[model samples]
Target chain A: MEIYLLILLIFMIIGSIIAIEAKSLLSSVISVGVVGFSLSIAFLMLGAPDIAITQVVVEVLILVILIRATITMDNTAIEGGGGTFPFVVSLVFFGLFLVFSFFAVQEIPKFGEPLMRVSERYLRTSAEETGATNVVTGILLDFRGYDTVGEATVLFTAIVGAFGILRRRGRKKKTEEDAEKVGILEDEDIKKDFEGF
Target chain B: MPDIDEEIRDTSKGMTSIVKTVVRFALGIIVIFGAYIVLYGHLTPGGGFAGGVILACGYIVLTLAFGRQIALRKMNNKAASILDTSGVLAFLAIGLLGYTGGYFFLNFLGRGKMFDLVSAGTIPLCNIAIGLKVTASLFAIFLALSIFGRFISSLVDEDE
Candidate 1:
């Protein structure tokens, strides 16, 4: 199972890179879906059923959005090879990242003993204190509620930024269009044919 | 688009309108699942973020398979904005409730029972609130992006 899963991970990573680099928007979207599915499976194997389920659900959603967005996209810009300098820089950066990861992994302690001690310490009483069964929930909501609040705030900021840009554009468009005697909409035939978004 | 459009048109021809309609229905069902996942996230693996994305996915799928016009008619941009705003308000209200009870954002609400899906106190409520916010916000973002892209593309074509 481990070997098979490793192979799947390789395939998934390679596929995702290709998807990200692919010129055809449709194919790229499909590849992203494939990557999402594979990652969900990997999550399950890692004994994180909740994470896996969430990942799968979110992945499907993102793919759908990407597909819809792609419908309206130009899809003309295909990534071309960078000049030699940039290529060399990227190679060096990637090599450094690999070495850092290797060192980090080697320095990490074994997961079993530490996790067991922590669970033994607070697994039962944790839910009682936080009023949640899932110890994870207890930690996230009760112990780290501050962090959660910050996270939610981050999400709020992102929404506000996006909303501001879109709302401003909308106001500009409406005002401009209102000044005109005759409003010209996109051709009905073209509108009907448009897909995805 | 000359080549790809032909390919897409040919591929889509093999797919029937019935298939698209069925897909739309499925999307509605998916949205329900999203609601369930988020509302009961305290007990389950899924939470607001995952569920919100799922809900957004449902709308996106319908929009893609059918058209933007159909999506606008069904969910509508205005209604989405309302949902988005209400979600934020609900979240703030819950957080403020914490102050009156004791600490801010307190889950003083008792956990009703264990292993029961609804047992987790304010956690579930927070999940639901976040879920709503996330769904609306993400949907709004994508809708704007899609509309803007189309508008710009049209402008470029007009210039040419």
Candidate 2:
């Protein structure tokens, strides 16, 4: 199991590298999808089915949205500039991240070992207290209800903002066109003639 | 003859008939499955968010297979906005209902037998509400982004 997880992690790293280095936006999106799929599998192997399910669905949705966005953009422009400075900086950051994560991984409890008090209490009492068999749901919707509300609010705000920006841009374009036509009309006798008609 | 052929081709803006037919056939099952996941969230590994995503995928499939215009006609931007707001409102109302029991988001309703469908009281209700909110919000986001992309592309075309 540990070996399988290690292999999966390696594959995820490969996927991420491909995603970053790919020339085309579509290929990068696909590589990122691969990474997301591997992460979902890791979640499943780690006994978090709910997280795995959410991850898979969210990954698909993100891929679809990204593909749609990229399809409409200039394909050649998706190929980013090759800059050695940015590359070197990213490499240094990657090395630091790797070293930090290696030490952090060492601190985590071994596989199958229960971690501390909170989870134990949640497992024992959540069913009875919340009347929900799924302790995760109970914790999310009951014990941590405030957090869920905050999350929902955030999602709502993001969608509203996106919708507002898109709608506003469209209206702005139309208004600008109308203003231009009005300006053109202002300089002519035809403006008064058209108004009278 | 060329004009007639062009008009015929314009009738279906999506993929081939096989893809559209398959998606049309499968959409109902996908929606039903999402509903099942949401309704049985208390007893299953999936919940509102997961089920909501699945439901949104069903709409996405519809959009992909039948084009944006048809899908938008089915659930337009205005309706989606209304649904999105209502979902959050429903969830807030459910939380507020707990005020009668002395706490916010308290499960005031009776807890039925364990593992039963209706046993998880406000939990299933909350899941359903969240499912609605998530589905509408995701679809709305997708629609907005895609429409924006199309508009931008059209502007680019005009400029060119």
Chain A TM-score for each of the predictions = 0.73, 0.77
Query: Which of the numbered candidates is closest to the native, going by highest TM-score?
Result: 2
Show model 1 residue runs off by greater than 4 Å.
A20-25, A75-79, A111-122, A167-197, B1-16, B151-160
Docking class of 1: acceptable
Name the lDDT of candidate 1. Answer: 0.72
Off by over 4 Å in 2: A76-81, A98-114, A168-197, B1-11, B151-160
| Candidate 2 per-residue C-alpha lDDT over A1-197 given as tens digits, one digit per residue, 9 for 90 to 100 | 98999999999999998897788877888999999999999999999998998999999999987776776676534545769998899899999999999999999998679685797888899899888998889889888887888888999999989897776365443333565677666546555445643
Evaluated on CA atoms against the true complex, candidate 1 attains a DockQ of 0.32
Residues B1-160, model 2: lDDT tens digits: 2353353245447668788778868999999999988888888889999999999999988877766656776788789889899999999999989999998998889988999998867999999999999999999987787665463353223323
lDDT (tens digit, per residue) of candidate 1 on A107-160: 766743354656675676777777676676666666666677777778777877
The best candidate by DockQ is 2
How much is the lDDT of residue A110 in candidate 2? Answer: 82
Residue A9 of model 2: what lDDT?
99
